[model samples]
Target chain A: MARVQANGVDHHVQVLPAKGAPLGTAVFVHGAFIDSLASFYFTLGPQFAEAGIDAVLYDLRGHGRSERPPTGYTLQDFTADLDALLDALRIEEPVHLVGNSFGGTIALDYAVHHPERAATVTVVESGPATQDWAHTMAGALDQATEQLPPEEALDWFVAEYGAIASTRQGDGRHDAHIRRLGRNAGKFIATTTIARDIPDGRVLSDGEVRQIRCPVLLINGSEGLVAEQTAWLAELLPGTQVRVVAGQKHSVLVEAAEEVGALALDFVITEADKAAALEASLDAALEGGRTR
Target chain B: MKAVKATQTPPIPDEAQVLAEISEMIMSVLGDYAPPEGDAAITLDSRFGDDLEMESIDLVTLSGRLAEWYGPEVNFAEYLASLELDEIIELTVGRLVSYVARSLRTAATAAAER
Candidate 1:
């Protein structure tokens, strides 16, 4: 656990390294609106670490324990924040990026903007940053904030997810997280600014997605709210691998932790294997040429 | 989340004392933030999220403190893995108190046996 000063804000970052030599590094970026590092910290980071990939999970600025500047909630701000954090951590090599929901957008955008720094980008239930997405998001956030006082909204979130207290919902830790995010969400106006700026910022044109040289993985839930977007991404992004968890929706990370974990682990391991083989082949070729 | 079955025990921990200690640690971290005062009732049912007003960072800080006091034998990582993200967020003081008690009991027993 390290408290890093990145992009002029203190970020809470937890790094989990492999038990042995790490095969590679992957960073987990959480989505906006009542989310935190805990989501990935408790699930993906540990699993990736177990599989020998160094994993980094950090609280995005204005969420969780990170310092909130009351502004800079746009995707650019977030991407900048990520870039600074990576630089602060001394990550010189190309690293894998796994982002969820809004984080997926950031991951994709970061890869596009800094192509040389990214080895691959994996997006789960990623909501692409587009004008249409912005309006949908604005409407959803307005509807949500207007519908319930934040407290009541949290209660409804808990109730809808499952049980409260020591019951079944807490059994999954979903209820617990909603409560944290629900409370955390109310403290910052950045939440509102982000909802406005992102759609307005006009993220990810077709050409940008086309320009992403890194390999991409697209994952979604069967009944995911972003079904259209998921389909669009899968179709638009060349060679994008897709997996949809049956009977799950937006919270696939929570509902299908094992499946998502296995998929991520498999992807990283396979990629590592490929890289190793490629390196070996290159070495052999160079040695043969030298001998000749 | 499944409990790490207790294998040994020396005695029961004073839940009251443990709760008070946790309360102090939480209060210190949350100082000048999260309303900055009040919510004095640190009960078994008082959740870290709702009642204590513990943020995600607060909880992470508290986990480190708890580990320092409880030692590595508690298998905090395993305990966390057992719960859903929701359960960790919604966790109550009572649940943690019990977890501490159980972990210590088992650790003590194992040490005696060893």
Candidate 2:
């Protein structure tokens, strides 16, 4: 893990290099609620590295070791954080952008607005924003009772997050460390600046959807609220693809991290080829004009 | 937002049968529990989450089933957001059958213009 200061905040970013000379880099953005860099460390990041792509993971502004402000926890803030990290690292070319849940939404929004900086965008179990999500979520959080005694909450988080990873890793230790991580997650949840996340602003206008010209791959668990929404989004957007992991839910990325990472790697490489092709064409045209 | 255009096609002719089917589908996904019985009249004015115990998650599942029955063109998000049990009950199965029966509807009309 590495820390960099950007915009008056100390942002934490991690990178995992491919075992045998990486073909490219994958910059990962985490989801809403809880700041677990472990998700990147445990599976997705390593999988990308093994597949010859360097993996980069970072904490959102307030959730992890990063600095937090009194306000500005919206999707735009996340996009800026990701953008700043990429610039700080001097990654001049487009990189594969991967995100999960809320992080996925931020990635999609960023790619749409900054298609030039992204090779491809892979979203896991995320969707277009709805007006009622924030209010509904606030109501749910308010109804919380007793915070589930750390142990019980840890068990639940492990079950939810680990179930998906277990399918991919087949390692019992993954579950154990995740349980421990979940215990410490209580503070992150309690301190989450979700009140500033305006769901309405996150919803993409039809015009914005039309503008996402890059290739997109959307992954979702077969079982969950987001699975269907993910499918809905894929159908609406041009040059978009979809994959549903059977018996999976909102935590599909953790459960099927390897498969997800492989899919993302493939899409990113494919998109890179297309970008390279397009750049070659543009250069040829420019050269022709200069010769004339 | 596209305006809700006047439909040339009337509600499905067999209102009672269609309502029963939709209710049954809802019941199946909703778990083992007693639901209201009868014909098209039963569906008219039925409460959504209360009488049916149809939470938002449940509604989204039902919405998926509806999309499958209707067509891919419908905006599932907008349609679900714009609904309530009371409003749902008022929409006779016949009305639903026709709503899904049509094509060329836009998200604006399905979401805001309703």
Candidate 3:
């Protein structure tokens, strides 16, 4: 666990180094609100490290252990935070950006803005920050701002989601974790301008999104909010691969971590191998020229 | 917050000491959301999820505390990665205590040899 000063904010960051020399680095951007770096820490972070990839996980501003400013929750702010974080870490090489939900939006925006630094873009249950996205986010945040303040609403959220969590885990016991999520979300909503800033944030035009030059992978649940966007995204970013996990929903990362981890591991390894091969061939060509 | 030098490592802690440390870490992480029964509720057989109501995030915080207290040899994330999702869900405090005790012993032996 490390507190990194980036973008003038104290960000909670965790770097899981690979067992040996790292093949590459994958920065995991977690969802917003109730989610944090912990989502990746327990799931894909270790897996990535064990597979010889350094996994970087960090809490976005206003969430988890990161310092929460009263405002500046714009998508641009998030993208800049990621940029400053990489600089703070002194990571100059291109990195694979893996994002979930709102984090994916940030990743997409970052790729659009910093195409040189992003090796590949992988989004799970997320989409780009477009006008439609802003509209949807406004409504959701407005609802959260309205409902999350009341004690009864929090209780209801705990009861409802706790049951779902238990059922999903097949534990047959209600989980108090839901309460933690509810309370944290409630506090965040009540205190910050995230609700307004996110929607009012800068959105990407189709042309801007089309500027992403890296390999892209989009994974979404069949019932997830962004599953339909897969086709449109692929059209915008040619050669984008879309994988829809059947009978799943927005919580695909937690619900199907093993599957998602495997897919991610394979993607990174494949991309790394291609990069290695390209480097080796270039080195050989240079050696051949020297011999001549 | 005990500081141990790499060259002058202390004796391996017993399971009881490890448990005490873990319990303290748990309390620190849980804070206001700690169980009503308090530290006493955290026993050998206490399941983190069911009994302590710890989510994965809590474990992440606890993992950080573990590293701070026990040093890098007791890698909670790597230890957890070795387990299946179900095994992690059903993990017990005793299981963690044993792992920490064993890791510390190994580290101590290596330090003495050095």
For candidate 3, the per-residue lDDT at B47 reads 94
Model 1 per-residue lDDT tens digits across residues A68-150: 76677888889999999999999998899999888999998899899998888888887568767878777765655567776
Candidate 2, residues B1-114: lDDT per residue as tens digits? Answer: 112333453344244555665666677656654454553333644655334544333444555465454444543333432443234323343445445434333433464566
lDDT of each prediction vs. the true structure? Answer: 0.74, 0.62, 0.84
* Candidate 1, B28-71: lDDT as tens digits: 66777644456455678978776766765576666656665566
Flag clash pairs in model 1. Answer: A172-B84, A173-B84, A173-B85, A173-B86, A173-B87, A174-B86, A176-B86, A176-B89, A176-B90, B8-B105
Stretches > 4 Å off in candidate 1: A142-180, A190-192, B1-23, B29-57, B68-78, B84-90, B94-114
Clashing residue pair totals per candidate (backbone < 3 A)? 10, 5, 0
Estimate TM-scores for all models. 0.80, 0.60, 0.88
Q: Which candidate number has the best TM-score?
A: 3
| Candidate 1, Cα interface RMSD | 3.7
Tens-digit lDDT track for model 3 on B37-86? 63456899999988888877788889988987788899998788667666
Q: Write the per-residue lDDT of candidate 2 for residues A1-292, one digit (tens) a residue.
A: 4688765568866676666967778888777655445455545776676677888877777755567665666777777778877888888878888888877878888887788987788887776553444455455444331446655665666675655433433344444445545554555555655543544245566578667766788887777557556655666785688877787766666556657667777777777767778889999999999999
Candidate 2 residue-wise lDDT at A175: 49
- The DockQ of predicted model 3 stands at 0.53
Give the C-alpha miss distance for residue A24 in model 1, angstroms: 1.3
